[model samples]
Target: MSSISIVPTDPQRWPLHVNAGVHHWQYLDLAASTKQPQSVAEKYFLGLLTELPNLPVASNFQDASRNGFRFYQKLQLNDGHWGCAYGGPSFLLAGSVIAMYISETEIPAEWKIEIIQYLSNTVNKDGGWGLHFAGDTTVFATALYYIALRILGLEPTEPLVSKARARLLELGGATAVPQWGKVWLALLNLYSWSAVNPIPPEFWLLPDWVPFHPWRWWVQCRVVYLPVSYLYANKVTKPLNPLLQSLRQEIFTRPFEEIDFNRFRNTTAPTDLKKPLSPLLRAANVLLRFWENYIRPDWLA
Candidate 1:
């Protein structure tokens, strides 16, 4: 079992909580908190903080139960049991920012600036970002934020972006990005919609008793997948622009014209690959591709 002491010992800096309906973290007062830092005695309240001496030495089972109850009671929070934290990952903000932008929702200026600052601060030392705060760079994350940063109005020529683009291209470019990235990029018109795997909305209409019924899957999986399938059926693409045209050039190591979108459909970086592709799924994809090309109904999409 792990203990709280196992957490890394950084100076006692406080968190700045930015709440825009959702909370975000920023560390502050590092210098002040660490300055004239507490001596070991002061930091842990010397021996007073430990229960070593006071802990019960039970003489029997009944005594042991009493001591256990006493210790457990001491551990309870003042009010209740529930608590939470932001659970840091680097990708979710891109989704929120993109959603706001697409819906034409007005983001406050402070939020926009803070979002950019957070992205700049989070860039990995190698210049690209990873899937999460501590993870190594992956095409999935790099592509998501690269597009997000652009949408937020950062120029491609900016040093952070230039460095990131170099790293992204080295990792086999945006074409090598995983399914999630492909979905977003297709929406941005940086990728062709046909290249993404199909998620037919008709699956939702399937009978509850069917073996592959949507309800049989985990609630969270089906909940997210339901809309993705609907959108995929639409084959949505953004109108072309200078930024997208530039992205097409910047994100690929190979000539864009030479890259076959269909070929890379199932390809994903080893680090970010969660599941191996099933043969059943691959066979299904072949049939779906045929349907998408010729047989699927227009109104159904």
Candidate 2:
């Protein structure tokens, strides 16, 4: 008969515990190094439960308004701003990570460790990470995450990095990455500026009556476009660090120089492109090119 010892009598409190099974001795040592309070664990577990009884669904405008304000109050940020969780899109994290890195923000080591742990834990059982944790594998999501780990100082030679790189290359490399992926790589100077479609800041200078005023776009699209226009107009590329140099080989199917980037301007992983490029969007890209080449400087700069 085999004996099984319960490691942390309450597993919920020690959520960061990595080991499994009847490893009481090992966990005892782990607990000695990191003392977590039972009360703290209880608090964390309670916070995870969101099954509060709902207020009666209001039929009238006044009651609904009052409830809405209460909900808003609960969602306030520490900085006095409103807070909302952004999910559904996996590529948002890539943008966020790049922005944090470029701004010279130092993420706490514990956060970095946990992020890696989460990614490793959540990766598909078949050995590939996906766009969303449950979504299908995609060049855009995989490449962005691969570069993010490298940016965080993970070695390209490591087995995990190598495996992800091989998956990316098999999906047709950086050229097959989505628009958002291209923007991130171009910002890092890993891809050519020409491969990206123009995101002209001049659009901001347009009249309200203009057919394509950027302000008319959806809020998320416009907000993302704002920084993109700023960076693109300046052709902003970070200095080539050693990590980026290694990424060149890790992300591509062949030599970086051999890639026909122009051919890939409209190319994106099928899995990542939920909405196909519209004819209107293609025409807009053509007009944006003309504006970028000839009209943007006088109006924007």
Candidate 3:
């Protein structure tokens, strides 16, 4: 069994930042010092559960419709908008946690506990996580989330983490993560940058009208890879420590030093591949790799 509650506080005064139409919410564990109000949704749900102990049984479409709207109305915010947790794409939190860990940022106690609880609760029966809540487990999610739980202070020998480790190794270890996952692991120094195909920043130097110019890419793809290209070009990595060193050994099937990372440069676990690479894309990567090793200039990088 599990429980959750709506965080009730002044969004403006606390950690909610709104600029234009964007909203960034941050959770803080300001125990005792701050007054937390009860949300209308919380009150409504609590009262509803109390009154209908056996649960409400809608006898008709009209009854269900009215009940649904009544519950939804309680969720509307005072700002005239509705907000809910972004519950899809299980990999996003792993990315955020990795970023925080590399930057030495401290997660608030409340958020940290909730993050751990959520990850633990969502683990699949096979002891791994998936791309989304209902999706099957893959190396990408399993490897990243495994590292995240470790960084959050869970012991490697703990049941949840040990199970994930067993599942990750069974799927060919962290080396089996997709290209995007490779970049992230490289950023943390868990995977060698050489194991990743080129994400050359030089691509940005090309004219916007060029057929493969990053500007022509879909906005979401462009925005993500824009910074990644810079990092990849510089071969940026967090300074190594005992924890990272331990992770290196734990996430791999073979000893870290004995593994041939280059062999996995273009490799992705079958479970993690959403789409097969096209012939054109494969040729482009080969050409890019050649340029990276032979022709790319340090000044441009």
Q: Estimate the TM-score of every prediction.
A: 0.69, 0.72, 0.81
What clash count goes with each model?
0, 0, 0
Candidate 1: C-alpha lDDT: 0.69
For model 2, how many clashes?
0
What order do candidates take by TM-score, descending? 3, 2, 1
Which candidate, 1 or 3, would have the higher TM-score against the true structure? 3
Please provide, for model 2 over 223-297, each residue's C-alpha lDDT reduced to its tens digit, 9 standing for 90 to 100: 889988898888889888777777787788888778778788888777567888899998989988886787755
Cα deviation of 16, candidate 2, in Å? 17
Candidates in order: C-alpha RMSD to true structure: 9.3, 9.6, 5.5
Give the best candidate by TM-score: 3
- Candidate that beats the other on lDDT, 1 or 2, i.e. the better one: 1
Query: Residue by residue across 1-301, what tens digits does model 1's lDDT show?
Result: 1111122223333233334334333334567656544322222321224233376789999999998777555443324332244424655787777667656687654455656777777889988888886788888888778877776777777777778888887887888677778887787777878788887777787788999888899996788688778778877666777877787877788877788898888888765677878999989988877877788788765
lDDT of 3 by residue, 41-136 (tens): 433422333232332779999989988877677666657676555756966899999999988998665566667877877999999999986789
Q: How far is candidate 1 from the true structure (C-alpha RMSD, Å)?
A: 9.3
Residue 286, model 3: Cα distance from true site in angstroms: 1.5
Q: Assess the local accuracy of residue 150 in candidate 2 as a C-alpha lDDT between 0 and 100.
A: 69
